[model samples]
Target: MNFDEFTGTVQHRLELPGTGEAVRATRATLTTLGERIQAGEATDLAGPLPMEVDFYLTGAVAEHGQRFDWNEFLDRVAEREGQTAPDDRADVAHHARTVVAVAAEAIPAGQLDQVRDQLPADEGWGNLFELVEADGAQAE
Candidate 1:
């Protein structure tokens, strides 16, 4: 429903907070944790895991503020992620715009998802990804 909730769910599923690199210490931890789980060496899958990470972004363009709608935000996230939601577009758009403003100001190129994970699920990730994609497209 919100960015934090969404990220928390993802982090829980991944069983580890992501490190900045595609492969890093977190990967090693996951492997070991996985082995432990498989061996029944650990009782709870969620508890033994390390602390969740917060991948925030930073840049100059990120400072200029903007606004978006929550419904639109959800729709965009669903659209980008290839999922479906039964919410009205207008309502979601409002939250989306607000989240976009925050991401636009805070995130840098390398840590969009990290920063996005900190946002409300219903409002920030979609706009943040859009900006990241736009920047990536322009670099080509």
Candidate 2:
């Protein structure tokens, strides 16, 4: 998807207030999610995404092997999103879920699956896959 289409999808999914909010949410999630998964897998996932998004997910990272669970995932998102307030974490996570759901549309399923597999299931990051569900239930 193009950048506008991407932002539109994320805004619609999250019922976000505006395109600006959607942009920030998208970037925050893409960057944070990139950090959560293996660098190689993230690069594969970024291959089919838009240039704007690809950079967000794969820019300047010499390594992307760090692993963290849901909480840390949200924390990183909040930091990237500039939502420094403690209460902003929940909001960041909520937006991040929508961002991932929207990202699912752009990423090839196989590459997306690779991302799912790369997340340490035991650490709870595997829950990221549920962000886009057939029944419309997102990762919690």
Candidate 3:
């Protein structure tokens, strides 16, 4: 998908106010994800994405493969999303899932799996893939 289409899909999925919110959601989720996973894996995941959106994975990562658990991942994403309230974590997680689901659709098959492999399933990191997993089940 192109940049507009990708952001539009995310906007629709998250029911955000506009493209700007969608962009922010995408940025927040992917950038945080980029930080959590290895740099090479992040680059691989970003490969099929729109260049505009892919930069969230590429441009913002200061250290790839940084070890962080799911809660820390959500915290960073929430901060990037400007959701300061402690109660906003649920919403932040939902937003991240939505963005990831949209991204799973955009990238080639198996690419997301590589990204998934980088995160530990035992640490609740699998929660981020809930939507993607559901979608896969439905497709099957």
How many residue pairs clash (N, CA or C atoms closer than 3 angstroms) in each of the candidate models, in the order given?
32, 0, 0
TM-score leader: 3
**Of candidates 2 and 1, the better by lDDT:** 2
User: Residues 1-140, candidate 3, lDDT per residue (tens digit)?
Assistant: 79999899989988888989999999999999998888889998888889998999988888888999999999999999999798989999999998898888877777888788878889998899999988872111
Candidate number achieving the greatest lDDT relative to the actual structure: 3
Better candidate number, 2 or 3, judged by TM-score: 3
| Per-prediction TM-score to the true structure, in the order listed | 0.22, 0.85, 0.94
Per residue, candidate 2 scores C-alpha lDDT tens digits across 94-119 of 78767777777766556666777767
Window of ten residues with lowest summed lDDT in model 2: 131-140
lDDT of each: 0.33, 0.75, 0.88
Q: Across residues 1-140, which tens digit of lDDT does each residue of candidate 1 receive?
A: 23444344334433444522212222222232222222221222222122231121111122212344434435444453333456534323332332333233323333334334434667443543463455352111
